[model samples]
Target chain A: MLAAARDAFAERGFEGASIRGIATAAGVDPALVHHYFGTKDQLFLAAVQAPADPEELLPEVLAGGPEELGRNLLGMFLRVWDGPARAGGLALVRSAVGSEWTAKLLREFLVARVLRRVVGTLGYSPAERDARGALVGSQLIGLVMTRYVLKLEPIASASRESLVEAYAPTLQRYLTGDVVLPG
Target chain B: MLAAARDAFAERGFEGASIRGIATAAGVDPALVHHYFGTKDQLFLAAVQAPADPEELLPEVLAGGPEELGRNLLGMFLRVWDGPARAGGLALVRSAVGSEWTAKLLREFLVARVLRRVVGTLGYSPAERDARGALVGSQLIGLVMTRYVLKLEPIASASRESLVEAYAPTLQRYLTGDVVLPG
Candidate 1:
């Protein structure tokens, strides 16, 4: 059912991928889809998939303290995207491009589950946290777009460790460093 | 003719938008479009649009040297997009999304025309320069996506000066910061 859901969502996008389509793709009755998932939104979420609950992971990430925050965050993200299953990252780019609902789902997941927890734990003002969150999100999303979607040259060729070494500090600056104006 | 070409390309996407359709829209001879643009590729470029040659702007930007590179580049970009003429930016994004040839145009304009010149003036190692270039390109492209296409909240609402202040330092970092890992 999940596999069918993935195909339907991927091929047809969120609006076009109806519960009936998923049911038909899975060779199950449409009523069974309702019985199993309750709603199309839930089914769509299930289809694109998330490896773990970010809410659970984010708190533990911050518990090590703010100093290691960038490394920990980047490392965790790198692990997920660079690990055996890379679908989450690709599906995410597709979602960001596809529909407002998926983009909202992504933004909520990032803000509530991942960023808010980490930033809330930090001793920064709302503006600071928002700025930092935006920069970090931009970097990570940009990295994924280049590495996974566009597969642009050396970036795609870069090893996971190399990427972390190069990028984590950029994240760290957003996380902690003072903002310096361009001269 | 140009108006028909633009609408067809924008609506149907590059592959889907045909010269015949454009001709039909324009109420002109198809041979006229062919005579004017020469090929579909050239027509796509015409449809996508390019700004004043980055080459023309590069010398002025680099005149202040590396110290002010970030400010100049980001400022020039914002001015271009915010000015009376932003159809070019819109065309660029539309083409980048819609067609490979158009993406090549973006790469040439973005990577070769804009980034390579700026990074070339900087003295980073080839590998480092490439990575840095990608980061800058991603941020700028991401800015266009957020500000122009997706019309996301804070970014869309952000004043030009506010955005320049917010983004310039990140661009500066990508341009010349030592790639250090978080402690």
Candidate 2:
């Protein structure tokens, strides 16, 4: 049923997809879908199949506050990749790379589920929060591309611990420092 | 001849393509291929295509150094997008999204031509340089996704000038600053 929903979502973007369509594709009655998952968004989330809620992960990560947030995020992401959650990580990246629906799904997961809540916790203004979020998003997305998607040489082969060490401080600054603006 | 070469390169990638094959596909003499392009690299460059060369544009952009580089790069990119050169950009993005050969071409262009040469001018180390380059690449690629491919609201509705104001500083930071690393 979830696989059917994923195919439907991938073929027809979020806006184009319908609950009825998913129900039909999954070989279940519409009421069955309603009983199993309450809303289209919930069904879509199930379809994408992420291992864990980034929202649940973010607070525990930021519990350390801004100081070690970068390190924590990197460490957590590495753990997800190294563990049983590897398929989930791959799905996120593949979806992000695969089609517009996947990209939209990934974007929503990043913003609504992760960035907004975390930035709210930090008590930043909208602009500051978004700027910082984009910075962090750029780094995380780039790392995934380099390490997993592109599979470039030494960086691709490097230990996850080494990458965390190399990248954490940069995330720390984006999170907390007054880095100079480019004129 | 050029069309066949472009298709072959797009399908097979840089290393996988051969001058002899391109010549045979084009129904041209192999000697003619050698005569025109001199080497496979030269032919490959012609096949892959691009907007303006960063080499020619970068000096003009950096003429005012760190202060105006953001504006300069943004302006340069928009001009390329707005001009007849957009075909190369579109072709490259479409290819990168699905085709491995095309992705290799793009990765090479980013790392070797654009990133290495342009970012290297800033005098950072190899790792630092690649990281910064990757960030800049993602931003530009993301911009393309929103503006041209996905046609997202606000971003598509945005004026080129407004986009420059909103994005140039971030681009400038990726080009020149200590970027935030992911947790």
Candidate 3:
């Protein structure tokens, strides 16, 4: 079922792929797909094996409050990429670079599941929040590229806590600083 | 010869691929390859179609002085990636994500060809310089991923100068600030 969903999502983006079509491809009822996966969004999370559950992340990350948002967020990013989800995370990132379909899925997942949920609670206009989110995304994605994918030395071996400390301020500024948003 | 070199590089990393091997694959003498390409570094740059020429970059980037390093560097990067080199640069980055061989070639090219030359003039110990280079790399690669590969909006459509203004400080800090070295 998950494989079918993956195929469907891969062929069509999050917007184009339909729940009923994915269900039909999976040889299951639409209702069953819902029962098993909850929604298209949930199905995607399962399909990509995304470990980013806003529910799990919100409280712990927000626990640090906005002041420590960058620190907590970078630590969590390191944990996810460095921990058990590393392989899946790597695969998804790898595929996303090569495939527009995968890139779209990743963008949708990031904006919908991760960025919006986390930053929505903060008091910024939607446009401002998105600008901030994209800025934050640029830094974090670069961290993953250097540390995990490219495996650049010193960075690849740098301790996680050290990375969090080094990078947190950058992310913090993007998330909370008075950035010059693009008009 | 270029095709042969690209194939050899695609199969073997920068260090692993030999001039002899590439020449043999091209059915040409190694001396002939050297005559045409000048050096292995030059050969790889032509093969990868890299737009980053340190000789061209160093004087321009340094003119901004160390304090303006981040702004100048980001501006240069944006110009390189956004100009006529966009297609080749995109291809190289996308391939690197999928192939370790490509990734290694990229790393060698980036470090030996680009990073080392630009940063070598700076006043820092080998370890400290490396740490700075890697941090700067993280942010720059992330900028590429978001603005180009991911096509994440606001960032995707954001003006080049706006991006430079926003990200310069982060790069400046990584390059010139008193970052806690990863000892």
Which candidate comes out best when scored by DockQ? Answer: 3
Q: What's the i-RMS of each model?
A: 5.2, 5.9, 1.2
- The sequence of per-residue lDDT tens digits that candidate 2 reaches over residues A35-96 is 88778767766766767667556666877777888888888876666678766776665556
Which is the leading candidate under lDDT?
3
By TM-score, how accurate is candidate 1? 0.67
Q: How accurate locally is residue B171 in candidate 2, as Cα lDDT from 0 to 100?
A: 73
Better of 1 and 2 by lDDT: 1
Q: Candidate 1 docking: what grade? A: incorrect
Q: Against the true structure, what is each candidate's TM-score?
A: 0.67, 0.67, 0.87
For the second chain of model 2, what is the TM-score against the true structure's chain B?
0.76
Model 3 residue A183 CA deviation (Å) reads 4.8
Q: Per-residue lDDT tens digits of candidate 3, residues B1-183?
A: 999998887667666889999999999999999999998878988987786566677789889778888888888889888888788888889888988877877877776666666666688888888888888888888989998999998999889899988998898888888677553
Best by TM-score: 3
Clashes of each: 0, 5, 0
Question: Against the correct fold, how does model 2 do in TM-score?
Answer: 0.67
| Candidate 1 RMSD computed on C-alpha atoms after optimal superposition onto the true structure | 9.3
What DockQ does each prediction reach against the true complex?
Answer: 0.13, 0.14, 0.67
lDDT tens digits, residues B88-181, model 2? 7876766665655666667766665566666777888777777666666656665665556544434545577766776676677677765643
